[model samples]
Target: MPRSHWLDPLARRVLQATGQLPPARSSATSNNALARPEPALPSNWFLDVNRGSQQQWRELPGCTDDMADLLVRLQRGGVQFAAADDLFRLLDLPTDLAQLWAPHLVFNWYGDAPLQPVRSCIDVNNASSEELTSLAWPDQRIHGLLRERRLRGFRDLADLQERLCLPASSVEALIGRVSFGQRRAGPSLPPRG
Candidate 1:
């Protein structure tokens, strides 16, 4: 039931007299402006994918419990996304869900930063013999790689993989741990005995 028209003025007078809500107090802003409500609170933070915690991801709009846990698991397992595509592909996130959460996600690289392990990211074209050996690759693979780089440096990960005969799985694992920067003409690794 609607309040009677006559009671509207009486209610306003009562409220004003009680000083609960003062009249003319909101006039600093125009009456039209007061009629509109604020849409939402603004946020200024973006989620850093590589370094984001599960809790942080869970706070986003569309993240599920499984998705949040999986994200943490992948990060812990040394998996880092290079972009939105990796997150979508690895998590098998739906297009609509990804779009809903895209604005909040960031894929910043936190390589070799404090508390983040370097994981022996050896450089094939530049690392010394010892550093090259530190990679979990086989002895023959390392020796062969050292020999090939002596003639000419690897063009990129593909070139390195081809020369070493590294399997698809090995190559996939090497994605983030190795980089293919411009091959420097530094002194080559001493010949392995």
Candidate 2:
């Protein structure tokens, strides 16, 4: 079928993927990179909600360091934003501030929350040895993770991978399921009276 046969965007994308629909003809806008408004971006221009780096999140105007950290932290932990509403609600952004970011945001994932894979992100920096062991990783990886963290905190995926020398497959598996943050410190029990 021709691309125009599918009126809906989702149907078109799905059909295109299945090779049932011909791709739409290219247009003058194919070379959009030259006129991209954001100059700091390395390659691709859009900031995708599903899978984008922390640096991409920071490119948005009015995106604070804390906000970027929270966004990346939450996303890395398996939280997916369905719409601008999700971002506004989770981040507690004022309407005006959300308005500023609304246009720049792109949602790559399609469909409801339950329909997607349900993987809660594990904070490698703070998860208990038990929690880390419960996952598919072997005992050696778990021990290595805990031992390395004893020396210092993991910074990001790259930092963790470099520090631990994780195999490519392990790092790939860890992408959305792992995050790094300051270890939650607990107060010691008060001295007995």
TM-score of decoy 1? 0.39
Against the unseen true structure, what C-alpha lDDT does each candidate score?
0.67, 0.65
Stretches off by above 4 angstroms in model 1 are 1-120, 191-193
How would you encode candidate 2's per-residue C-alpha lDDT over 81-175 as one tens digit per residue? 65666466545678877866777778876444323222567888888877786557888878888778877788776567677776544554554
TM-scores, one per candidate: 0.39, 0.40
* Predicted candidate 1 versus true structure: per-residue lDDT over 63-148, tens digit per residue: 77777876675566555666675566545578877776677777776664322223345667888777776677788787788789
Best by TM-score: 2
lDDT at residue 106 of model 2 (Cα atoms):
85
